[model samples]
Target: MKNNNSNIKLFIDGFKKFQKKHDNILEDTAYTQQPKAMMITCCDSRIDPSLITDTKPGELFVIRNVANLVPPFEGDLRHHGTSAAIEYGVLYLGVTDIIVLGHSNCGGIASLFSNQNKIKSSDFINNWIDIARDAKDRTLDRCKHNSQAEQINCCEKESLLISLQNLQTFPWIKDKIDKKEIYIHAWYLDLASGTIEAYNSDLKEFIPL
Candidate 1:
């Protein structure tokens, strides 16, 4: 493994290059962040929402969490990081579109198959991942004959649907969607193929985007 000094140097070098190339872009949007879309995606090291979408900084309001899962809206005072980000994006930032982006080979999603007792030691992961328990159950039931990789892929896509549904559970989000002021979407990123697919509500399937 590389030394921490080298990793820090790599970032410093990369930032120098980025500053030369995008310094003006950053300065233009420094004071005001008026992003048009909000994307809820996995906190996976392999995926960068901005790079994948060819979007620049300030163009996207991104919320990254394990398995890209979104829990149903809860009216409480608890510290809901994901929910708080969504609320800020929609109500404060006025983002017009919300996207739930899921990717292949997600370890977080794969944890759904692990023995619950094994992860009981985890302080928060076990509970956070349970948000997509229904998706895992559906994948197991529908793809029982498939291989483990295939089942994980199925769950990966299905988990996005659950997140999308959870987004609507927020009363403000649902109201905006009903009034046609905001739109919601689900997208899948196939890491192996380097391709993206969007969920078609009318067709009830994912198609190349």
Candidate 2:
């Protein structure tokens, strides 16, 4: 309380308002969470799943990371945070839908367009963003005539499709899909325009929703 740090003060002040608004919310969702959908989205500060979807506390189970990329399923034992979350959501939570929420002006997707070796930190980011390598390649090949900005934008959407395909790599997810028990989707948010679009698998394009 003594510290005059604006960021900490902001959180402390904001929590009071949030607490007043959802005083009984904790009591309802404390012991269990039965979210209907699992959303894999970006870690961008501007992207708040609850606020964007206009959902309350236990309505959505959100998993956020760089670019919202989902790596293909692999059996070997390794630290798989995203994959683990997907498994928990699909199996234990019994979420009927898994949605990959991609957004515009994504730093992770933009990094894919640049030369990896040129980046100062030859560490986690490059490795992590590599999950969307295929998406970047597809973007480059398809949007050769477009500007760099356009290519990056194109890859942003392409990356969502790649995530959808990766979701199927999980055997359990595929089984659930086969039985029509669960569905996977790709959604893109244009931050500049404040527009949200859903991927239409039937038409093979993103449509405003």
Candidate 3:
């Protein structure tokens, strides 16, 4: 415990405890090769999809990224991890519901308002975050008079809507949606209050769920 090597040993010991639990999870998941639902959620350490949903292993096919932004369908790109995961979940795994889950105090959404290109130091992050730039633009355009906090809140919610729209850009997804084979959902998690809200397309608002 006195040196860096000691710290590494302590970390490994903790990991061993986690591994024991993971082994049981693996056994439970072995029989369920395909998940029934898919979720796209933020890459925040505080937000654990399974824990939040009270789901066990193999219950959800999850794709996580900064701000949970889903890019529009584009064939020009050779590799798209989010889209690839979605395609596999929908087409291969036959997932019926896809949820885009956004959370409060997202660094990626906050960086959208920063003067400097915050992610420039990390090229991949900068480029990936550009996918949700439209949401940021919409927020700025409509909330010019609102407080900074309100604007950020609007952007966070709008980003979920943007991802829902982006989901439609995939022809397969669109077809599944049209056929009622798949359903899309948007959600926002307010960390301060521990309340989760689901978007009501019919009501055109977010409602507590």
Candidate 4:
């Protein structure tokens, strides 16, 4: 909040540059959007899903949150940000493909893996993170002998699968999938190595891209 604090100004400056770069597409996105897909990814500063996917403003509808998480639809009236976006994409936008993207060194997953005590004070953060506890538990149960880093990596990948599974709990999405109208995908981004892997159900593993 000091005069010397420049991140806000830096973002403003970056927006000006971005405006100059993409002013041409502004009109197209302003009137309507026909994005090819929808993506749920982390809120990490380093993970720019659009840039990574080489997509412009209207190409992909995106929902970002801590750890890129999605909770199963409970048929309640609460405002679930991730679920709302998913509904809008599938029901309104008619997005054929939905992707749940996870990244390495994810602070959210890492926090679930390591910092449970620290987040207990914030009710929402604590409860939201509890969604991925199963992923952590599964990874630990299966990889008892692996090192912490390897276990964390396993947890990260598994959590993406968990979200993919959770997507099926939404009736609309499930119906679309059952009728072959839509598809769900899982992607893992290894920021340290700058590579991506896509989940293959047949292979039961992520294949490098």
Worst 10 residues of 2 by lDDT: 114-123
Error of 2 at 21 (Å): 3.8
Task: For each candidate in the order shown, give its overall lDDT on alpha carbons.
Answer: 0.91, 0.92, 0.89, 0.89
Greater-lDDT candidate between 1 and 3: 1
Tell me model 3's lDDT, rounded to 2 decimals: 0.89
How many clashes in each structure?
0, 0, 0, 0
- Ten residues in sequence with the least summed lDDT for candidate 1: 112-121
- After superposition, the stretches of candidate 2 with alpha carbons farther than 4 Å from their true spots are 1-6, 115-119
Each candidate structure's TM-score, on Cα atoms with residue i matched to residue i, is 0.92, 0.93, 0.89, 0.93
The digit string of per-residue lDDT tens for model 2 on 130-205 reads 8999998999899999999898889999999999999999999999999999999999999999999999999999
Candidate 3 regions off by >4 Å?
1-11, 19-23, 115-117
Error at 206, model 2, angstroms:
0.8
Per-residue C-alpha lDDT of model 1 across residues 35-119, encoded as one tens digit per residue: 9899999999998999988998899999999989999999999999999999999999999999999999888988887642345
Residue-level lDDT tens digits of model 4 in 39-127: 99998989998889999889999999989998998888888888888889999999999999999988778777664345546757768
Clashes of 4: 0
Off by over 4 Å in 1: 1-6, 115-120
> For residue 78, what is the lDDT in candidate 4?
89
